[model samples]
Target chain A: MQQPIAILDSGVGGLTVAKEVMRQLPREKIIYFGDTARTPYGPRPAQEVIRFTQEIVDYLLKFSPKMIVIACNTATAFALETIRSRVSIPVIGVVHPGARAAINRTQSGYIGVIGTEGTVNSGAYEQALKQLSPHVDVVSVACPRFVPLVERGNFRSEETYNTVNESLAGLRSTRIDTLILGCTHYPFLAETISDVMGGQIALISSAEETARDISTILHDKGKLARGDLLPVHQFCCSGDPQMFKMIAQQWLNEQIELTPIVWQVPHIG
Target chain B: MQQPIAILDSGVGGLTVAKEVMRQLPREKIIYFGDTARTPYGPRPAQEVIRFTQEIVDYLLKFSPKMIVIACNTATAFALETIRSRVSIPVIGVVHPGARAAINRTQSGYIGVIGTEGTVNSGAYEQALKQLSPHVDVVSVACPRFVPLVERGNFRSEETYNTVNESLAGLRSTRIDTLILGCTHYPFLAETISDVMGGQIALISSAEETARDISTILHDKGKLARGDLLPVHQFCCSGDPQMFKMIAQQWLNEQIELTPIVWQVPHIG
Candidate 1:
């Protein structure tokens, strides 16, 4: 039996990553958890977000996954290192892959990043970029409003476009040749974001880049699943099973086995 | 006291990878070996190519590099596993990175690969692609003439264009939406190859992708150089030093420290 790659997110945003992982590594099994009971870990305190992420990881660990992907930018910003120390298996975060890709794509040395408030406040992307190349200039913004829209499945609406346009107005003026969609939820609104940013600025999707990194790391370790048999994937959510199922199916374009977990953190919601 | 990344190729072809590693990971130092005395490893027998690559790896090991990059496609196709087993450090190759990039870019599932006779005959790219996804259709062609042109320092002449155009005619006719510049030497001729293949096909350069992989692997290992000092790189070749120095400076757009090594292999050249 192939050990699954476990993925966890604050909400539906991580479906973007799951979709790409499936597309890129078709043979690998996946087990995903969404903390919809307390969605939008973006605006929460760092400690709270880290605690929630640890809980989800602990729950996912029951299946003995080969790798854990922190698909949420906010959680990756706050909780990646702590989780890395706690887990023996390889744990990947979305931030560095996005940052590395932005560094690769940017010709002007100026990069723009848009993420959740928590992630922006953490300055993860900036740290990751400058750590790799000190000469890079980073511009970061917090888009606290975008995640709710994505969670509600309000993609492509006029409100979505207007919000995206107004939110990115400051970034549009910069001479940034590359923009990193620093949040996993951001890719759901990529068309709107692309329309606002125009054709010149290359948008780096953390979801796509993270999946590619997963492939690279797994291939290096000789852990990639080699069997030809199709692997079954499992999806779990902490709240509102119907809404989670609806959005996940529409986003993933397939039916998923979703198990709705009772909220274990009683004080949060 | 920084441990440099050791990159070796059959000739100056590996300079493509070296230049990218410099651009993307500016903080890291590099020690590069180009076996120019007996280059064009494409037409050689697999065992001979393996022995030559092992020799280069043994020579490069003297630098105590943190990682070994088999930057030539033919050498990677023939000798990566052997080198990896022989060396305790991480061993990276050009093929898998290019294959991964091609897989990421190809929407039509039809991919084209052009390399020297050895890489094409080894079927490494097809195997890598199909191993990841069983559905991709691969079109492989061996361009036996492109390497000598690059080695001779002839990049943008009309003769170069005609040679590139003629060599890729069969590939241009295919439905491939992505083409892998399978040989590290191929990127020097990218503009002409792009012109021949047109804009519809996305070109995947192994050099750039390999550099990105190097970053990913190094970051994961917690061994990325942290100092702010400007890294001085060293380049060595086993053949004509003048032509090698001229081409290296021209392609890298910077003056490089070059050393000429007396040819150690008496039987080949």
Candidate 2:
């Protein structure tokens, strides 16, 4: 009944985080924004990713939400620090949670990270993991093919498997005990990945961990919702609302109406 | 790592489905048996609860276990037909998994269940809600004092202000969204639980659901352990190292070394 928790991502990938949030915290309302039109932010420049994230945050703040969850790994990698400095409210990102989970799970101290080129190239997961445990051995692989496969909803297909298998072939030799699915979209491919990685390796989902972080932050801040008002959820996308709507309904398992939002240009000085 | 999926329960409470099958089959070697010391086979006479559950299962099938995860709840309730007739390998229980998770998260269901004198008497928290939900538009109160005021492990303490004020007092008046956290364990007092429950209502834990049903029943029963050996686990218990260790260590986290089991003779038999 108070302000909803605002979440934003480059696209539907963030829905994974949203789904977990909904399951773990069913009482809270959510206002989600997906810049689907310009998704695969993994390929974008850091400056551009930060600008887009800032714009979305600006729009989302209008709701006076209790917190903001940067559900996109790339956005978190590029803009989390910037956004935290800009906003007075709490802001959470996926990378740190994912890294922390991976750190906790990996008994071997050897960890593998898979994400888009930008995320892997940015060395976000590697940095975060090392910061937590300086001795952890981090190996990152850029799977530029994954975001496209997920965005197109091509999981479980032979081709998707082939792509994943090929992309992750090198890591097989790494002997890492944990693999961090650095992107939110990766959970949908968990079965395939788990098969490829074997049972011994724990695959940490950034989305799941990020949701856990959100829950902790909310509780610690005393910002958790109390009453029993049925929460109203708003889903907006900068891309095709039809696709977003279909995915939303399927993901949330509830019939949902989606609205399209256009980024407003800031006035030049 | 060979054959082991042994499960048991006492009078119920399956330990959140063996802690989500040790956090999603961390290499498939589980030997679980919940002695609960006396065992809770439900309404049936002790003889029946044991004969149908105990004798048939053979004292937690202490041997090389391939797959056995009864995890309590409905297994003891409705699905006894399937497990009894299905396989010869092993069997499982139902209470742990059931108690671990809320049956259904409702926005307005505000379900209140009365567990009766035995359950409420057991301080199980079930009886308290049923009676309450039926009334206050669906909210229950249990003065059972069974559920510990975990902060101090004192349910009667006046100093447990936040919980007493936020949860009991609020649920007394407002319509609750969902009531998870059914078990009285202090671990349920985690930040995620508090943030998610947001100080109202009652609910259960589904460690399996939390761990995604043990990776979808071990990847659809291909019996999921793959390469990367190093899969060795020993299950031991606190009371009797033989009969209780698997379920105990899985329920409680620690480095456990299991000793061989030899079921004690039944006095009645």
Q: Which candidate should be chosen as best, given DockQ against the real structure? A: 1
Please give the TM-score of chain B in predicted model 1.
0.97
i-RMS values of the candidates, in order? Answer: 0.6, 12.3
Please provide TM-scores, in order, for all candidate models, with all chains considered together: 0.97, 0.54
**What DockQ do you compute for every candidate structure?**
0.79, 0.03
Model 2 per-residue lDDT tens digits across residues B1-269: 37766765432245555555554455556665544443333333433553545443555555666655555432343344455566564333332222223423454655432221223234333422232122223444432222234312233344444554444444445566555433323232434344434656444443333333333333223355554353555443223443344434444576566544424424222
The best candidate in terms of TM-score: 1
Question: Candidate 1's error at A237, in angstroms?
Answer: 0.8
lDDT of each: 0.92, 0.61
Backbone clashes in each candidate structure, one number apiece?
0, 37
lDDT tens digits, residue span A1-269, model 2: 47899999888889999988776566678999888888889999999999999988998998899999999999989999899889999888889778766765677878999998888889888876654455578989988888878777777999988988999999999979999999988987889999887888888999877776665556434466665555778888887777778777777799876753443524200
Give the per-residue Cα lDDT of candidate 1 at A230: 83
lDDT of 1 by residue, A218-265 (tens): 988889999999889999888788899999999999998785443553
lDDT of 1 by residue, B1-269 (tens): 99999999999999999999999999999999888889899999999999998877887787899999999999999999888888889999999999888988899999999999999999999999998888899999999999999999999999999998888988877899999999999999999999999988999999999999999999888889898998999998888889999999999999987854435533434
DockQ of 2: 0.03
